[model samples]
Target: MTSAALPPSASVTVRVPAKINLELLVGPPGADGYHPLATVFHAVNLFDEVTVTAAEEWGLSVSGPQSLGVPVDGTNLAAKAAQALAERAGVDEPVHIAIRKDIPVAGGMAGGSADAAATLVACDHLWGLGTTKQELEEIAGGLGSDVAFLLSGGTAMGSGRGEILAPVLARGTYHWVLALSEGGLSTPAVYAECDRLRGSVAVPDPVPTPEMMQALRSGDARALGAALQNDLQAAALSLMPALTDVIDAGLEFGAVGGIVSGSGPTVAFLCEDTESALDLAVALTASGAVQDVRRATGPAHGAHVIGGPRPG
Candidate 1:
């Protein structure tokens, strides 16, 4: 007897969360010209949704509030991810990707990386590649340093150019108020500035403080807030002096702690609780220190398929 024909593959959608650095320590540039880093990555609720559908031709489109700056071509990380997966799987099928972004573009939130992570998961499911998580993580690491962490999300420690990952044990959620700048800062530029500012000084090996780890272990938001640190803050502030004003404004509004989010123009203000986050968001918005303010909670899940599969 003949077997029945298999059903067509279904489309897949993956939602990925944005990230903030709880502790970002930057060491000297390596022989590869990339800085060595030891950082704590915390995934927040701000998310980007990536949808993959099999198509006759590979194409990418972006929508949503922060989508204007994203490239729709192969240069886009999401596209690169899909291409990489296809190449790895030896699949010739073309796929169409639609990114619905809420994460700030190039704002040190790893928005692009999030999309790439989501695409990897989505396309893998859509194409029935059955790629293992380890295989997907390897592809993610090749795409970007932050992409690997985005694939896992939650709380993790990153080293070796921020691709090496170790899960962090943390107890409670952390509330934050993000102040979005009018224009995003270029990460490469920020790193260059950091190099320049550290000229003549011996860069030390970057390491996260024990206190930060302890705070997370205890689930003490106040302690965590006090322990928040970013090595790139000085460089970011040097490049965008106005960011200092934003940080000051956040503190003035009773933020427990405020730091430049990675190589950022976006400022993240830590709050004691949800109420404090809301209050800070409102105050920062009213003060006009930032173009926009958003409230989010950290310790969110990584890229994952959302909703049930749909027929092709």
Candidate 2:
């Protein structure tokens, strides 16, 4: 369905959730240098906000805990998303984008991808493009692999460099304790390390385990925790050994399962319930095993408008 047409002075705001990989099985690198993946993505309550307003020239700004590292120029994914949508809609008028981030930067939580997804939705609404959901998804895929998933947050299976998606049935919420690191891990560097580590070994096709799916369907956190896995964990740990300490600490604090969220640095611990998550967060914070400890629940809704159009 189409939204009401917005005036040239109208603005739109969208909120997008950060994602963690419950399972990230990676195969050998393809000709394109990207490893094939079989992954289950879970969107957490952590979010980044993007607001778009009509402007004379395309401009961008960021403000939040992690904003210092985010680019405000064309290099930013949000700006790229806006340009892509403008080209598709054949509108030359520019937009001003403002971002407020809570998701950790370069923590493998797809924070940039979340902003990109939010920009696409906000701009489409602001410009009254009336783009279909499928159209937006197609655009999202071009922006990045994880961007598509950010467009429809929840539990889902990702394949083909993580762009192709199939929604998985997830029964209930899962509590998580995220241990944020002081520094970010480069995604490309982690992938290269994975390739280097597996130099001669014949890699098998990545596949998701049935046990994990069953646990999700049953809403059993412990079972799901036992099934949590990430092929990139070894490489991530190799690059940043300090993460090992964080993982150990989380488990010691009574986490059922813990894994590097995606590529590196940030570690996510699965807790049995809300109370357990709070306890874990408190312990992790007090122990100083990480830079910061935050609690979140999954699966959260995808990129969605949180502010209505108002006269400029």
Candidate 3:
């Protein structure tokens, strides 16, 4: 039996979950544009599905509520994944990739990264390339920072521009209330702002705190909430100053802890349990400080096949 999910037919569909950074420590940008990162990534229930079908020419389409402004061309990360896989396998035939997005676009949830990871899995199965997990991760590394984490799912520590991965000892599921924004913040812009805020201060290398690691290991919700940290939080707040009100509302509504999700606009509120998440979601939605409110459980599975591996 193959360890990897197999494609049953001409088309392969894969579902991938969105990711949130539980702890994000970003260092100054090196010679390369990317900032050094030490982050704890947790996949959430929010998902996007990508289906790939063999086609004479390359094509892509995006649908679902958050598909607006998404590129359906080569520029799309999904397309890049497929093309890269094809190049790796020396296959020239093209496959059309269709993405059904439920994850928020550019919402600091790594929606695009999830789609890219799904496409990689789907196309690999479609072509019967027999790509190993390590090989796939190598391809994913170039696609985006969060792409590699989405491929493995669960909880992991990411370094080296968030491409390098190491598993974390996360013990249990975590409840969260996400205050999503209608408009997205550009990650690059947020990084620029972070740099601007730092000004001339010498940036120190980043490391995940032992307290945060201990909380995840112990599966203590309150401890995790208290330990939640994101270096990008201040930058995100600067970009969307109104986000302060959202954070305030989450805490006011009894969230154990609240911080900007990754970049800007979306704020994550940690709750004690599902009951707390439900109440926080309702309160955040009613507060009018956020565009939308979503409750998600974290440590969800990463990209995996949910469709057929039909009899060939």
Candidate 4:
């Protein structure tokens, strides 16, 4: 087996994007399934930059607006990726990671997953492991359901507990306006809320059919906008009742449709274009229901190689 060796003072920088679920359908309860889901994810330009470097020992240092609750030790997914790679490659070298967070943590933006993907990519290059993108994605998938998407980046369909992926043809930039929340809503908690809401309604439905995927490919803004749906919205609204007004406010300001980004709290508002997105951002920032607002675009590429050496 190969081993990872990190030279002291080695460092690399990586930029990773947040994700938006374009469409999500909830399925019936399984033995373990809160509900099987069908989701189309779009990686946005909004990102958290991570700098990894070699140190005397393994450690993590996170800085930025959204670092709270993020683990700096082995518990962090970035650290976990480093350890996993070390074991897999049979390398013993310490790594030091510094995450400069731009993506909102726990805001349903896949900030942690992005960091993990960046770590895997940066560490591989830093150690001269020459691990392929596919190999990195496989390891990332092991890290979490959303981890692979972080590696893949861009527009893609997620199914089978959101691990399986089919890259979609979302060309041209799709603009977005994100409403930041005060804190995060737990994924498990959101799923549980869906289950609880499901108990009150009829049995959950099956995942969306291929037609929905075709709709995204058609790229008609209205068609895509009309087709956008989320199984988790009920749970998200249940957890944060105020989200209802947030959605309404976004629509009132001329957004096509607004939905919770992933689990809860953060809401992604689909806009007509980049100009409209900026306008919405300005307006939504003043809206009382949110913390901050950001403009983003989709059909964007997933994680990519940067010119720098890997961080430790």
Question: Pick by TM-score: which candidate is best?
Answer: 2
TM-score for all predictions? Answer: 0.96, 0.96, 0.95, 0.93
The CA lDDT at 294 in model 2 is 87
lDDT by residue for model 2 (85-187), tens: 8787787767899999999999999999999999999988787777888988889999999999999998899999899999888898999999999989999
* Residue 25 displacement in candidate 1 (angstroms): 0.3
- Evaluated against the true structure, the overall lDDT of model 4 is 0.80
- Candidate 1, 1-312: lDDT as tens digits: 111222334468999999999999999998889999999999999999999876767899999999888999999999999999988888777778999999999899999999999999987777766788899989999999999999889999999988899988899988999999988889999999999999989988998899999999999887888999998999999988999899989999999889999999889999999998998988888898799999999889999999546333
Clashing pairs in 3: 8-309, 8-310
Off by over 4 Å in 2: 1-9, 310-312
Report the candidate with higher TM-score, 1 versus 2: 2
Predictions in order: lDDT:
0.90, 0.91, 0.88, 0.80
**lDDT, residue 253, model 2:** 90
Model 2 TM-score on a 0 to 1 scale: 0.96
TM-score (C-alpha) between model 1 and the true structure: 0.96
Candidate 4 per-residue C-alpha lDDT over 1-312 given as tens digits, one digit per residue, 9 for 90 to 100: 544554576677878899988887877778866467788888999988777787787889999988888887788988898888878877777778888888888888888889998888877877788887777777887888888888878888888767778877665567788998887899889988888887767764556656657767777665666677778888999999988988989988988878888886899998888788888888888867788888887755566656566334
Of candidates 4 and 1, the better by TM-score: 1
Candidates in descending lDDT order: 2, 1, 3, 4
Cα RMSD of all models vs. native, in order, equals 2.9, 2.4, 3.0, 2.3
